[model samples]
Target: MKIKSYLLIILIVISAVGLSVCSYIYTPAKYQEYSVGVDKEPVMAPMLKGASAGVFPWSPVEKQEDPQSLAKKDKVAETKPEAKIEVVEPKSFTKVDDSYFDDAVFIGDSRMVGLSQYCPEIDSRATFFAKKSLTIYNLQKDAWIDVENGPKETIFDALSKISFSKVYIMVGINEIGRGTNEGYRDAYADVIKRILEIQPDALIFINSTMHVTKEKSDGDELYNNGNINVRNAALFDLIDNQHIFYLNVNDMLDDGEGNLDESLSGDGVHLKGSCYEPWHQYLLFNGVVD
Candidate 1:
């Protein structure tokens, strides 16, 4: 009976020892140092299940965001309203009568001289400061205009002595082969600046260089309708539509294919005395009132 009792005691001691070992192995790593006498409170193990049950049991799990959801959020943040821009329209030309040019002055080369001599209505009303070979380059330098009962003077000098409401300029035909398009435009701009200085209140009209006849354009390389178009394009850039305006007389003179009407001009460059009526009519039709 004593041996049996001793055997039972030994079995109970072994069972208690096995339970203590299993408890130590199953405890979380943070709680492995826990003791009854330690002043530090025990940290509770985080509840974990499924795939994260045994791994990193004490650490907080980070929530992962979906890529599509992140992209949607970014797209929403980027959406905004587009800004609007205001555009201004250019001024349009209106028709006027022959009397509209009564206070106007015409300035140009030989074509202008022809207009002065041939067009009786225009000659009767408007003043002319034109010569046979006047150019933008020599407009202010050369003393070309022979003032009636006055000495021959530059166009600017003559203009300064007179008060005019409008000034019409058409002198690029003589300067076609002289310089580049930009050089011609700059010189023309300088002439306009000087004219504005002399006639401060005068509205300036820049007439396009008229096209040459098909025969003239086909025969010459530099003096063709294509070259005239280039020079006119350069001059068109100078118009402000407020004080300066472009008058495309070629609208009345050009043939269907962009050459001067064969019936209108004799020399392919200058219009006939009779054809000056259409040129004058163009001026009468395209006048700005204000």
Candidate 2:
């Protein structure tokens, strides 16, 4: 009985061992799939650290950059330096004043008398051949200015006595109503020619007649702007724009409506000495230098 029981136990143990081996070998492929849940990571290739593959024709470089560099990268912007701009100033002409008219002579009627009486700027440096009613027709014969400790000589005689560098003549206010434009122009030319004959080196500045006051111009037909403009236009014939220049003093004293500023004149004809500063300034700026 003991021998038979032992034999049965031995057979059962042998069948169990055989069945375990067969179960592992005969499992179908359908049931032999990879356990994705158990093995979370994918199969990995061997690492080729610091190794280079040949660059492709379209690629810029051969070696791969760092893995961190290849990721969705935060680009660091390159800052450029700023360029500075420089400003340049333009060049212009040098203005000439004061010393230019030092040796000048002014010849006129009441206007010139006003300047000599009022303007110390004119009196200090210049000589004036002027009288209250001095006209172009009578300037050479009748006009006489007081000289320093000398006899009052005629206008033509005074010019001959001294050789001046500049001769500034302003005439025609007294003569504008006296004669035709042709007669006035002829008389003016005669005065200019005589001055040139006496002082050939003199620069003759023919100043235009200053405009009368608006009241005088509008009231007196003879002293109107029409007559003055006609006379002013006629004076340009005497200018060569060389040594002879036409300086329009009317512009200096005008009220901008083609009439003299009422404030500048005591009479409608002559400017007060103190008020003629702008006239002196105009000459200082516009007159020629040596």
Candidate 3:
């Protein structure tokens, strides 16, 4: 009985020691670095199961984006649609025959000097009376005039000498400097009324006042070229009859710069021989040529 009791005591002590050693190796704190919970199963790699568990948790499998699918998305973004556009064209003026005049009267300021110098062929189908340094209505008495050669002549005094099939008039650059828009229109209408009173059957060609540079001198500044542009607009508004015509002769002469080139005129205001050449062609093309 004594021997049996001693053996039982030894067996109990060995079992307790074995349990303590197992607890230290597999306790929650031993695997705490890998976050393996007490109730959860630990995921140890096949090679690491025999060795001590590592200090990292098992990582999830990574997913990769497809390159071809990403490229297709980019291509769709680049292929966006464009907006549509439409183009429009402008209309042109009608052509007319111009051989009807026999005796013509050309009137205006210095610009008429160029008209007088154009070859006789231009007015050979007609006779011409061209006056320089003149205005539409006599500036002095503020009356309608058939001729305005200084302020002295009455309109009747100026009309006494001529009968015309056509009358070409280019005026108002001077008036715009001193007169209001309404004043220029009223005065020009009065002049046209008087001219028709004198030559009722004649065709009237109202020429545009030619363009000029912005003059710096005292003489030209008050009558700046912009004043002429204003008069041109006013003149365009008063055109009513088909027999009454508006010719933008400046289109044939301007270099686009406000000043007329010497090739166009020696004095920057008048048209020269070179300038007259294209104008003559235009007159011919438009049937204004004889």
Candidate 4:
């Protein structure tokens, strides 16, 4: 009888073990799909305690460091020039608190419209107008000067309507393609001068011309890789005033391949609504907005 009881107990233990194995093998997966749960706290990647990614990508590594060498490095870092960042605090724009300027004005070609749509909140502070392929020459086509409207409108048009405290301009990609570097520079400089003359106190923010793919840029014979270099050079040449700030929002917009991302622009010229958010963030970072 005792032997029979032992055999029954052994059978029961074996059955239990077999059943557990079968259940695990046949059960459906707890989670079939992979997802990142927003409710859970984000897990940051572990970083090294002391060292960081160095600035120079191809720098030669040092074999060893002594106390004197470490001291030398500290001294070198202290003497190294700090990065020159173009950060303009919003206070500069808000300082006057003028009743006439509760509204801001943005004027340019088609690019301005996309920028406006991407930044609707900014529209609350100002009215934005972007006439497609419109230029000062078009506005005054009948005039004796015979200026065939260029890529953008004159700064005077934006200034004439309101005592604007802030004016943002992004133009010249169209005109730059058609004209010589010198011509583009002169034309842009004239536009800037006109804006300052009309509203001496208004802050002016000049946005850098964005890059486009080589395929689209190839359409115009007058425009080439050299055009971007010339236009940027001209833009920087005129930055002598404190109030007239320049923001190179292009650096962030580029896809790191020396060309604009096709996803950012609808027609290789005008940016999509999705593209503007990052551009806006870049503007804020650079102090273009207060």
lDDT of each: 0.81, 0.71, 0.59, 0.60
* Evaluation by lDDT, superior candidate among 1 and 3: 1
User: Which parts of model 2 have CA positions greater than 4 angstroms off?
Assistant: 1-95, 143-152
User: Residue 54 in candidate 4 has what lDDT?
Assistant: 31
Over 1-290, each residue of candidate 3 has an lDDT whose tens digit, in order, gives: 99999999999878665544444354433433443443564333221332354432233323445799889988988897666676533222344333544566666665665555675555566544445556765532443343455554554345556677667777765565665787777887777777788788766778887776423212476565566767788877666544566777767766666544446666556666546676555554443322
Regions of model 1 farther than 4 Å from truth: 1-90, 148-151
Model 1 residue 30 lDDT? 27
Better of 1 and 4 by TM-score: 1
Displacement of the residue 72 alpha carbon in candidate 1, Å:
32
lDDT of 1 at 243: 80
Clashes of each: 0, 0, 2, 4
Candidate number with the higher lDDT (2 or 3): 2
Candidate 1 residue lDDT tens string, 1-290: 99999999999988666644543443333234333322432222221221144433344545556799999988987885567786656666789887877889999988889989999898899998888878888884788778689788888888888899999998888888998999999989988999999888889999888889999999999899888899999987799887899999999988899999999988888999889888888888888876
Name the best candidate (by TM-score): 1
**Candidates, ranked, TM-score:** 1, 2, 4, 3
TM-score of each: 0.68, 0.63, 0.53, 0.55
Q: Model 3 Cα RMSD, Å?
A: 19.4
lDDT of 3 at 246: 76
Model 4, span 50-87: residue lDDT tens: 11433122334345667999999999999999999997
